[model samples]
Target: MIIISTLVFFALLLIGLDVGFSMILAALIGMVLRSGAGIDPVMAPMTLVSSVDSVALITIPMFVLAGEIMNRGGVTRRLIDWSAAMVGHFRGSLSQVSIMTNFIMSGITGSAVADATATGSILIPEMKKEGYKPGYASAVVAAGSMLGPILPPSIPMILYAVMANLSVLRLFLAGVVPAILLCAGYMVICGIIARRRDYRAREKASWGTRIKVTRASIWALMMPLLIIGGIRSGLITDTEAAGMICVYALVIGLFVYRDLKYKDLGAVFYHAGRTSAVILFLLAAAGPFAWLLSESHIATAISQAILSISTDHFTVLVVVNLLLLAVGMILEPLPALVMFVPTLLPIQAQLGIDPIHFATVVIVNLMIGMLHPPVGLLVFVTSAIGRTPIWSVAVEVLPFLGWSIVVLILISAFPGLVVWLPNLVMK
Candidate 1:
């Protein structure tokens, strides 16, 4: 009865109900139904707040602020310039630059939406000017933006860590190799599509000019290193390191680069605050939902259902991957992670899967969700920024989606790709 009511509430949510209110109402309804059967009401929301009150959650706001600072401070632009110089010699080089720039920007921002917004705003017009179709440009930007949260210092991972009772540091480390592999995979897909379309490379700058561009981008590049290094060496926690990134962005923008002004700080703060609030509320609401999910035996039911289908670990992975992909198409990453990780973690653990690898699987799947139709936030953001039709961009995004699926399969098949770095470094 609790499960049935929960499903009904989620169905209403899917039809345009506000997620926070929908979740709270659904949980409330589920509790009422269960209480009639002699269950309790107070446990769910109490568990929800308890779930969300972790110190790790502080990273969300700091990282959001850090991303805003980097975006407004010219760091993101410099990264794009340097990435373009590095890859512009190849066929369809400009398209390749979109992927590469997202890779670099991901290290600093760690938010896929932010990456799509920042890089797409610049690259969409440039790609169109360079003869790429409007849809294609938006597609590339949307697909490439997945890099931001799949990589290290990923805000989603922080949420997943708290939700699943896993190691945040290990999850951050686990993402490194898969993130690199994901970027490479997308580059290959971009190259293939570019070659087939007879896309042309950008004008090649001289070696000296390329070197100068790299030199200019050095400060921006160093931001990732400092954050990663700080985490690896225990010099600072991820939360403090995010604050460090804000300082880095502020200094580089105001004093070093001289592009970011005092007046700009207000807008950056406002935007970051807004973004942070949405995520925090989602976290708070999911807290109760997750608690109720556990108490209602959803996690056990899922694990039992999977085992009933296949005791073989490999088969279980395949099914889980498909399930997550389908869910990703409908749900946003943070809420999805909060809700699903609790259910899935116990199942994966029973199969002896590494928690870190499972977390990567969860993230990559959610990242794909950010690009698919109807509910794909990244696709919408990219289309809006490019000022193009969403359907056109969705069509253009097809090849990249195929590319993402391929990588997803590889990561699922070989958990080592996701777990290797985290184990090597964190151990």
Candidate 2:
């Protein structure tokens, strides 16, 4: 029953079915076939609706709305300009700007798609004009945009924290060092590639230009600090911080930057609403599919399989990373999280792994999956923007992908690297 149900889930996904509905229908099939094994069809609807009952879930729409406002309000433009001025003098300067811009944008827009599309549209052309290959330009955007979900205010981390019954702030904190590490890895790869390709560096900005650009982006730069500081100081919960972010972005968009008009509110709300609705529905459907996996004891089987090979901590961590990476190659991160957080989270505790460490590893692995075939959202966005073939873009992104794996390994092997910031701050 488990094997057949698993196949149906992936089969539905491969056929271009929407992931949420695919999970729901696949789950219905699982219940009907495995009803004797404590899977009840009648409970599926209840599970779907009830899955989104938490107050923490309120943060999704708020953050989504904030991101939309920032994107539409000229915020993305200012952020990009600032990053370019500050870092575009380096070897592979444009590539460095892409990474730095995405790192900043990650705080405002936690969605990888948002980062990829917003930054890719602006920078891919600029990079190409500067003599970068279209495929490599697209590749840089796809790789750098991944920082969106790894940094604070990340949407994926919110989902994982809620599912794992962990603190949202702590999970956000846990991502800090790894986010820096990933950026460093990406920059190192960017530098090496730049040297090989002889990518030209821009003239260093005059101090006056740097100061002027930085001053112009002051409000944009304060955003992440405001959200993270507010939450870390215990002045607001994640949901409150999100609401504050929404209001702050709106004010900045309407008054400060004056890029967003009152007339644009309707479209902003509509788009944000649609995006939020899709995620909530996926979360709802995931409840039953995940429940079905639990009833079938798939987690236990996988856990036992790992232990059979070896009980050593490093060996187990490696095996688990491999499994999640495999799951990521097929399913989008959210659905994969829905199905397996229940499955592997318990196993993580059983092995004495830290939840924050495990959460960071799982989220990062799935995100890296976003750069490759089948369902890499980042690759598709950048490819379309750069007018490059997805196949070619995928090839160009390989080096960044390899460096990301090294960062993943660092976090997985050294729990202290992942947990120390959160432990220090939260304590």
Candidate 3:
């Protein structure tokens, strides 16, 4: 029944229906077929309401609004300047700056598509002007955007924690090491490609210039500290932190930077509201869908299928990772998490994996999906912005994809790398 419902959901998606509607309808179909499962198809409407009832879910809009405000408020330009000043001396300097800006923006937006649009719009043109292939430039931005959901204050992490009943703080802390590793790894890849392509490097900024650039971005830089500090110190809950950041972004964009105008508020709020509504609706619809999956004993079936092959923890972990990777390739991250996490929780516990560790792996794996097809939103954003062929950009993204898998394998094999920071800080 779960499988049948999932296929229906996919067919609807492929036919151009919105994910939220598709999920709700698919779940409704399942309930109709299995009307004896103790859950009525009629209750589907109620499930939609109850799914988004959690207080933690409020952060979704707040964080998204903050990101929208930052994009409009001139934070993007300041971060770009700071990035170029700091790393422009390196080979393929523009590409390096794109990744660096995305790294900083990750903390601010906690979103991949926003980071890609914000940074890609600015850097992709500059890279092309600097003689880098447009496709390569877009691919770099697409690859770098994956960092958005792996860093602290990530919206996806918040949603994942909300659904998994895991600690948001622990998940935030767990993201630290993985974020750093990815940032460093991406820069290294850019450097190697730059060296091979004979990409020109920029002049190293003078000490005075570097200091000035750093000073300019100081307020923007403080945004992340404000978010992480408030949350880690228990000064605020995650949703409260989201609200604080949105307020903080507004102040900086209005009074501080003065680039965001009073007139812009209407459009900014509208965009945020629209994006948030889509995600929230998907969360609501996925509730009934996930419940139906649970009622179908999908988790038990999957567990049995995996154990039938090998019950060894290591082998089971590999199989689970592959399953998630495949799932991610097909679904966007939010819907994927909402629909799949419940079905996997039992398998995770039986495999003796730490919740935070498993959560980190799941987040990273789904984020990689953003760089893939046929629903790779990150790739589409960059490709559209750079005006490059989508296939060309996708092909250029292959190396990063391969390297990302390596990082995925590392974290999967060594759980402590992900969980250690959370344990130390949140203990």
Candidate 4:
């Protein structure tokens, strides 16, 4: 039954079916088959709704809405300009901006797709104007935008926390260093590539101009501070912090900057809703699939598989990272987290791994999946924005992808790098 259901799920997914529907349909078919074969299937419906019933789940849409508001409200432009002024004079400066912008914006909004949409639209054109190949530009955007989901306030962390029954706050704290490491990795790679290609730097702007640009972006810069502060001070739950972000973006967009208007609200809401619908639908459908997996004791099977391969902590970590990265290439972030968190948490604990650290590494690996061929969401977004072919985008994204994968391995091997921040801050 499990084999049949799993095959059906993959078959549907390969045919371009919505991931959520594929999961749910596969699980429902599994349930029917099991029940007809004289097994009780009463747990199916319960698990389906239970999965989506998480209070943590509410944060997803709020974060999605906040991200949309920020993107449309000119927050993205400010971030681009600020990063550009700071780094754009270097060879391949625009690519650097994409890396820095990803690092900075990741704190404000945790969705990788949102980050890509917000940053790529503005930066891609500038990179092209600055002599970057369109493929490189698309690649940089797709790769860098992944930073958002690995940083604090990340949606994937929330999902992982909920599924693993781990502390979201600690997970958020743990992600800080790894996110910075990923950003630095990308910047270094871009620098080397830029130098090799003889990419010329933009003419230096006056210090006064740079200061003006920074001052102009101060409001935008405060966003990350606000989110981190709210979370650390216990002033707001993660969900509330998400709401606060929406409010902040609203004030900045509709009133402060005066770029977003009443008419724009409708469009922003519609787009946000569309994005939210896709995510929520995935969640809703994944619920049944998760239940099915639990029923079939897939988690036990996974745990046993890991233990059989090697009980050595380092070996287990390597194996798990590779497995998740492969799964991430095919499944979207939410489903992947939901499916694996339960299965892996016991193994992580037994291996003496910190749940928070493990979650950070998992999310980071999954974000890299966003750079993979066939279904990398960020790659598609960049391709659409840059009007480049997907194949071109995929080829260019390889370097960034390589950097991210190395960073993932580093995080997996050296768990303290991820846990250090949480140990300091949460202690």
lDDT of each: 0.83, 0.89, 0.88, 0.82
Which window of 10 residues has the lowest lDDT sum in candidate 4? 36-45
In the range 1-427, model 2's lDDT, one tens digit per residue, is 7688778987987888988888888889989997787656987898897789899999999999999999999988998889889888889999999999999999888998988888988899999998999999999999989999989888889999888889998999888898899888888888999999999888998989989999889988898889879998889878899999999999999999999999999999999999899888889989888878877778898778888888787788888889988887887888888778887876788888888888998999989889878778788889999999999999999999888899889888898999999899888
Candidate 4 deviation (Cα RMSD): 1.7
User: Which pairs clash (backbone N, Cα, C closer than 3 Å) in model 1?
Assistant: 48-287, 48-288
Error of 4 at 424 (Å): 0.5
Q: What is the Å distance of residue 151 in model 2 from its true position?
A: 0.4
Question: What is candidate 3's lDDT per residue for 238-320, written digit by digit as tens?
Answer: 88998999999999999998999999999999999998998888889887887787778887887778878886766777887
Off by over 4 Å in 3: 36-38
Estimated TM-score for each candidate: 0.96, 0.97, 0.97, 0.95
Residue 149 of model 4: what lDDT?
A: 81
Q: Which ten residues in a row have the lowest lDDT in candidate 2?
A: 34-43
Candidate 4 lDDT over 1-427, as tens digits, reads 8899999999998898877778878888898898966655666567667777878878888877888887788778887878888888877788888889888888777888888877888889988987899989999988888888877678778778777887778888888888788888888889999999888777777888889988877887888778778888998987898888889889988888887888989988898889777766766677777777777788789898889999887788889888988897788777787767778887988878777777787788878888997678888899999999999999988888888888888887887898887888888
| Residue 171 C-alpha lDDT in model 3 | 91
lDDT, candidate 1, 163-243, per-residue tens: 777777788777778778878888888888788888898788789988999899998888878887887798898778888
